[model samples]
Target: MSIIAVVTALALSIIPTGDTPTVSVQQGAVQGVQAEGVAAFKGIPYAAPPVGPLRWRPPQPVQPWSETRAADHVGAICIQPPANGDNAVGPGPMSEDCLTLNVFAPEGATEPLPVMFWVHGGGYVNGSGTADLYDGSNLARHGVVVVTINYRLGRHGFFDHPALAAERPAEEPAGNYGVMDMIAALKWVHANIGRFGGDASDVTIFGESAGGVAVSQLMLAPDARGLFAKAIIQSGVPQGATSRLDIATPSGPPLADRGASFAALKGVPADGTAEALRAIPAEAFLDPAPNFGGGDLVIADGRIVPTSIEDGFARGLQAPVPLIIGTNSNEFPWARADTHPMAQALTPEERTALIAAYDDADDFQGRFISDVMFNGPARWLARQHAARGHPVYLYSFDAWPDAMPQPHRGAWHAQERQYVFDTLSTSPWPTTARDEAVAKVASDYWATFARTGVPAAAGQPAWPALAEGHEEALVFHNDGVAVEAVPNAARLDLIAALLDRLKAAGLR
Candidate 1:
């Protein structure tokens, strides 16, 4: 047997399993199984399926069922391309009827506990909450309730056709249907989480990558106000001017134009209605066209994401809540990575000036990408939260798994997940005692943050709130977790200056 299987079996052997646990939600009673001291309720429908006539529309209420429903297994994931090596949580069979969520709570809990609603990341294209990497059992064992949810993905989730817009009610805005599905799940939690021993008023929405972007978006979404009390953004930042709601410059086409282009590719005429596009098989939209390159599908629609996220933060319109945000040490390899707007705009002289401080030319690109895309944005958000007088804790994950053959691999994107969820055994990498130690610390920090606004535990280092001059963050390493000043601040500052120069030149 695999090490993970052996570990899982050993873990399961300790907890006695017997009588199934049942909880009555708003729709009906759900029967779940209890194992390892946690009650797991899976495949609970939070919204009606967006299929057939309801395609591309805002989520509707689920029909109630009188008989007890069995929420023992996960529902179908959203439509997307099959998973590959790049996407560890490979795609499974998908269906339109996939708007479901899972809840994990401490068994025999006398009162409602804090809720951590997780959003998985897949670049707004793929991923499901049911990914094995996101098992909440270990986290739930810490006495907090955990929730994982699935929303629409790719074109099916974020499409905006002019004909469709015209067909919808005047009051309901179009596009960002995936975001709408998240809001629906949150609303359901607010109404029914108490039944699962979760405190609705103490919801903490957390996510990684695209999931992090969703959390940031939720902070700006007016409809999402009051749904969550705390937020954790991992390796995600807000889209700047490129995603403004009202702007439709050549560089950033309006939603209707984007829809028209996509429909044209699908052989639908320019004047074709939304129904024509919806009638096409869902699979037709899953695969990217040969050499197809496009802008973000998760754009700001007037109703869901009212304004540019940057504008919202500048105007202090974001939901004022305690936040913990950070990124990995090495987000991605920067070699020939000319895709970033900053990278594309940088002159040779500007590039030379930016790289002068770094000794290793080989690693410069990776570090630059990490700083510009993930670390810099995270710090900017931390500063914003601090300036607004909200509690904010920043972090940098630098721990490398000993199981990997490469010795110098810094914490790459999504690596912190195994530690944060205390599921190191399930990871493909061969874990060590140091990994377990880090996992305990990271998971405790997360659980503590969910319980209270502060991300502190009895034995771990005391994480301080971000403020002027004291711009410190907790660095997670294999050796230990410690509070230290932000690393590579000078290099990041240089990159930020170049980006400012690009903005002044009107490149964006």
Candidate 2:
């Protein structure tokens, strides 16, 4: 049955039947569900499944469906490690045919609203857009369209090999299938979001952690230009995060070399064909021993990611759009108290200066790791973007919830997500009155940013944009929001200086 024929038949069958929202996209018509004043479309295939012969190739167009496909529930999540009681991939079963996205919009929308596209983070190895914590229904109620998408994960998403390269067109991308999936999804949204009352020209791409890293890469990607007008990166881009496609770097060997090693481990010859590599069962790659997609997930593949993020920013090559980049107060708890790797990079005098600045060795160790890995890099990126005369906002989230276990020191990585999405009700931790209040403010700020390019929440401190020398950040604490100097600036500056030295010497 052809799509035209299906549409003709559907019109005869009382198409759009009552209040169910049905949208016609390039592929075909899709019927969605409505709830709580929000119309949601889930499991909408933006591209064909990357299975069988299409295993590693860039996303291909989905075959046109002949009928109004039901998009009531999310599609299967991409293959990943089993969740340890954290349903990271949502309720859907795991499979390779997981390139689907969901959209949440006000059911009574009368005009095109700003679009907020969300990318999920899981170390580039796991996670899906279907997770309950990521539901955009509540966020959509704030006068914007919200979208969440699932890209390929693990080896299925980011693998490279000579055979795969040999078989592909010279211009096609390799080793960054996940990145390609994101671009494809964005293109789909640009073409189809208007049907859901979303302004395609006002799309703001945002994400947390690896998703945030993806947003940064997208800003650096030439293919991703003009696809979005704004970006928000949360705890992404630890300094020196990029890798090479075919050469060794201080971070790791070429991704192709790793792929060849994995192929050899799976009993394929070093010169194996792409067919043999794709023949290996997807589940076989899930074994923890091989670490198929581990290490340096983003690669400078020349076509997609042309250069390292820092270098791109330094060279003024990043997308000249509004930016919001930040990190958590305690991204990682440092266990080693006696010695820290950062100290090795410093001289005796520098170490003495750091010790004098921060008295407690154990506390310094933990904050040092967080600063070097997350906070410092965020500030540096914010500075670089701001230097380019772009509107840049930097924030540090330290909102510890009451439901958190005893001795709650500070907000941990990704904790701001619940507040950002106003989804505290989904948390296993009991939601307190203060938590709900913070969530309202947090979501308001995010949604407002998507609408106006400025983050403003009612009854909260106005979030300020970063300037060349003014290194201020909006602080989200347990009590409420406040504008303050970036915490740990002195330590972060020292670490940044050491990291610069290491990068110059190619030793980081």
Task: Report the backbone clash tally of model 2.
Answer: 0
RMSD of each: 6.4, 4.5
Worst 10 residues of 1 by lDDT: 7-16
Q: Clashes per prediction?
A: 1, 0
Model 1: residues with Cα > 4 Å off, grouped in runs: 1-18, 85-91, 244-252, 290-295, 334-339, 405-408
State the lDDT of candidate 2 residue by residue for 150-236, as single tens digits. 999888899888899888888788888999999999999987887777777789999988899889889988999988989999998
After superposition, candidate 2 runs with Cα above 4 Å error = 1-19, 238-241, 292-295, 334-340, 504-506
Q: Judging by lDDT against the true structure, name the best candidate.
A: 2
Q: Which has the greatest TM-score? A: 2
* Alpha-carbon local distance difference test for all models: 0.80, 0.83
Query: Residue 424 error for model 2, in Å?
Result: 0.9
